[model samples]
Target: MAPIFSLFLVLITEFSLATAQQRNSNISLGSSLSPASSNSFWSSGSGQFAFGFYPNGDGFSIGIWYATIAPKTVIWTAKRDDPPFHRDSKLLLGNDGRLILQQGEDPEKTIAGGSQIGSSASMLDTGNFVLYNSRSEIIWQSFDAPTDTLLPGQKLRQFEEPNELFSSVSKDDHSTGKFRILMQEDGYLAQYPADSPNLVEYGYWDSGIKIAGNNVTLNLDDNGQLYLLNNSDNMKNLYDGGNVSDKLMYRMTLDADGIFKVYSYGLNRSDDDWKVEWSPNSVHKCDPKGVCGQNQYCILMNQEALDNVVWFNDPYSILSNTSRPDCEDECLKDYDCEVVLHKDDQCMKQRLPLKFGRQQNDPVITLVKVGGREFKKEKQSKVLIASVVVLIVAFTVLAISGVLIYKYRVKGYKKLLNSGNEELIEDVILRSFTYGELEQATNGFAEELGKGATGTVFKGLISNGKRVVAVKRLETVVAEGEREFRNEMKVIGRTHHKNLVKLLGYCNDRTNRLLVYEFISNGSLADVLFKSETKPRWEERVRIAVNVARGILYLHEECETQIIHRDIKPQNILLDERHCAKIADFGLSKLMNLNQTRTNTGVRGTRGYVAPEWHMNLPVTVKADVFSFGILFLEIICCRRSLDPDLAEAEVILVDWVFDCFDSHELDKLVQDEKVDKSKLERMVRLGIWCIQDDPSLRPSMKKVVLMLEGTVDIPTPPSPSSFLSSI
Candidate 1:
């Protein structure tokens, strides 16, 4: 029995040792991975990081990401700018030592190519994926081709060619974004917009080390210290993270907003993760050039005396004879002028694509020219006499025509009566329903769906229950309600878009006015976003946001007559059975002719969603609707109300809290524990901020907003939107 026990123990020990060896073994040549395979990824020995297929959009992408993280964070990607590969694609390390990707019998694409051949690969614990030769020497490594992140023990070296780290387009997109950090040949590290020339004027940040003929490298140590090292072995500390605990992981990243930051996360904790440990503070918040695009200037707030001033470089034309007031008039009059700088009775005019704007202590008054319409004054006496004559002639003609039409209608009615048929008033454009028919359809207004400022909505079935409809019974039959009913009918009746609610017919009988619309089955967006037991998926919210934007775009630009949806909120958006969003509630909308751009009007939206221009008595335009949609967009992203008094004091106002989180690099607070596409989330947040700008000119048109939401255009960094709120 003792001999048998010894043999059993030996055999168990050998088996355990063999298993351990296999677990730690390097990936051999000819190994492959596919999305459908059970072994889809090659993980590091500690199972902290992996290299293989990752879910991207509706397909798969070859990348390296943290395997243990709750929301898997990708650090490196192959073919970063290419569209995601299909599910049938495969990644293979060929026997000849080439890493290749094959998609459905297509030609193999080389992922990592080099002169060295016949090697193995490994997904190292340092978050680096490496290919090694027969001598165990690294031939190619992902660390050498960094994307947007630098893990601990990684180095960015400036050798024969300058090393650059481009920011990702968004949290979800690994493609190169707008900004990049370059380790210059002159031993100075600088940040610039990716599209701009790598010149000093384009650089937004620099390490200030300009020594030439020295090898420079940026390194991140395991202790959370980031530093620059030169050939003399001299180290310049960029950020000292104060020796982070072993239970924490650190990463240095150039964020999508063009802010370089060092982040830390606790390994043991799940919530409240990704804290910003270090970010540059030596420069002003708005020091980054190209943040605002051509013809735009950035406003920096909460600055010292010297920082309050704004300056533009290289004005195309300077007029020494112009006065300060004349400077503004000059820019406004000249269609080519974009901005004007005036000082000591001299006006300097800048043309389109203003460049190199900065803030400094100076006495120059900068006036920016935005778009506006000019109204020519007419002679009052001539206009009044002409109007009176036209009215007298029109009244006489209308009276004659009215009598003739009435006599013909009366004769026709008598003929119909003689024929035993009821007289019917037919409208070619809109079907006119009688009050009795609507009442019968709604079963005497028995089932109430909702109540709004104008009227109450009732759910009903018509055509013997074959068709469902919503009937909005107007409460005020007098001047105000009558005007709203007519306006809504005229505005929505002619507009046609999939995202806009369909107006079936209307009832305008005696003192009753009702609007009949096709029934939306899913309810209001507010109910789905705020009141539902389970929050809608992120994809759904994004789709709803785009749908709402398209609806507003159609109202603002695509329709025959431009319309301003004075009230655009979650409650005004209805969803159908497939969760497709459609914009409703047009009672407060305003119409504008093709020649008109803006109008002065009273505030007409919900309190929390109203644009700042309403309170300031400024001219309202389609931008007002844009501002309201901005508020609604934020609500959709965060799945919270714009104003919630039940939350903490700092978070009570959703816009303020969202901006604070965005400013502080703590956007995780906006969607705690929820898995979201970080890139799209940030893009939406930036767009919302831009839409809510205090200055109406800063708000983008709904057309551009749709383009940005659809990822067809880039969204610029936004300024503080709380200026009006703070003043109030």
Candidate 2:
């Protein structure tokens, strides 16, 4: 009887143990805080965040979104790159204490993997999804890895260490986009294009200015402003926000168009509502990246400077002058550019260079939203300053002297010709030829090398190779052009500078005018600077910069008529086989008595290369040429075009950007091209900045510009240049 009773007790205990094992098998505990089911994953008790195989976009993923708030928003994602193959994908704990995402029935078919060491998945009150192991060790936490949306305590950078950044989601799709927010080597927290290894470089401030040691806290105030706080004391305000203190939550994101936005949330809101906050892009279409070509500046379309209010001009664009018809053609050649013309006003902008590094030349300020919709056409309240003017977006004005020369040469106004009044050239030799002779000799002008403002330059062998010369033909003859043609010949014929293109002979036939010059086999400097096929290397670039400086010096000081190559830009600078720069395009050239301080005239010269004083109706002097030379110098140092679209956001117009670095003594930042040698490059950047001082009296003379290029003259530190006012 006793043996039977013992057997009965053993059976009951076995039955109870079997039932408990069955229920436990269906559920697993990689963490004891909350057990995970075969079909469902659990979030820690705080309810601030949740992670599960949630439905998003077209598929599902183990994603974390805010659960405590009314509106759910995904803040962190584990498998953002690839989604689950099917709806049966499960998140479960393994016997080996690992968190694995298994597809369908196969538990080993891992879709995602996480260390189960501390494998308890919990949600912090700060909306952070943290996964820890049993020993109280954090294995993977959402705070350390952030997506596009940034939380209050999360940092946009890893201090001291550079280039560390967070990823943002592409539009609609949960996939990561090609933009990142990171700290640059130059000590600025920069938003970089995915393909661009350098900063997407919207603008930079002094991020290197150290705050109060390790106890510093980065605070995103209620307004969109981002601040660095040392303990309880404010150290530095990193971002410039007008109302960053009004909101309860703030998040900054890299938008789809590569623009960065700072968004703010109302009280106790889950996802923050955002406004423009700040955008690096222009409000007026006129000041587009490439609207006025290589040397032109874009004027603002609207007079007002406010956010969300776009200036109105038909087609939303404008030009600085209406003289250069070729400006349109030059603008179209840029890769990431688009042109819009309205009522004679033209605007060009970057076409959202989807490929990274392509839009570096045209930076736009993109503002994104976390809770609200992306910025689209909407009614924005703005204070109207004044009546809307018929603002100009694009126009190309010819030089005043050039225009005068045209008027004086008109057929009906023969008295203003000034044909024989040669003020600069002493002994004038004149030769006339019929159209037939020129056409026959050069094979119908078929041996054409290139064209300039004056006319086409054809390669011709005169006297059956007695001398091979370049014949330049002036196609159009304006009423006042006769005097300009005469002045041009006098200036080049008498000037014997090695840096200037030499004039050999001349031909004038009523409407047709031709000048013979020494033939240069190599092409214009524009080709070498822009076209990669003929791109000049570091050594070649330095030599070209030095050679051009010498030529400017000759025009300003040594020439019989102190000449200003008014249209001084890469396109106007021609290169010889040895890569020596020769100053060309004297059509816009100005002549002044030697050592004269000023000459008043309408603004001339290419856009980006023109000096700021020229815009102020000030006297054109050697300092103007110095400003141009400074632009060219930096172009050579960076191995990029002057007024490049890439540096647009940094507001890096040639002189201003260089002077900023010079004032800071951050010379190494100018060597943008990785291929260039560092030691040699810094010297060139320093020299270039010195040549472009704002005060005309403060600028170095061309004689000094040449000496600095030659590594002989020591350059004093340059003062900060005035910020370039946006023209578009």
- Every candidate's CA RMSD: 27.4, 27.6
Tell how far residue 385 is off in model 2, in angstroms. 81
Residue pairs of candidate 1 with colliding backbone atoms = 171-679
* Candidate 2 per-residue C-alpha lDDT over 1-728 given as tens digits, one digit per residue, 9 for 90 to 100: 99999999999998887665434322244432112334444454444456666565656656666665445556666657664345655555555445665554432332222434443445555656655566756666666666665666665443332124334444445557655556432223444444332311212112334343334444454455676655447557767666434544556655543455565546443544334555444223332222222212222334432221121111213344432333344345443233322112223222221111111121222211112222221122322211332232221221000001111112311221134212111122333346666666577888888876657889876543434667778764444566776766666677666677777567656677777776676778777777765455555677788888888888877766777777777877887654578887653345677667666657777777778788877777878888878877777776567666666666456556666666666656665534444445566776666666667788888898778777787766565655552361
- Candidate 1, residues 266-379: lDDT per residue as tens digits? 766557468888888865445565544443334343332322234335565778778766777777777767656667677777654444344444456545554432211111
lDDT for 478 in candidate 2 is 46
Q: Give, for candidate 2, the lowest lDDT window spanning 10 residues.
A: 399-408
TM-score of 1: 0.46
C-alpha lDDT score of every prediction, in listed order? 0.73, 0.53
Measured on C-alpha atoms, candidate 2 has an lDDT of 0.53
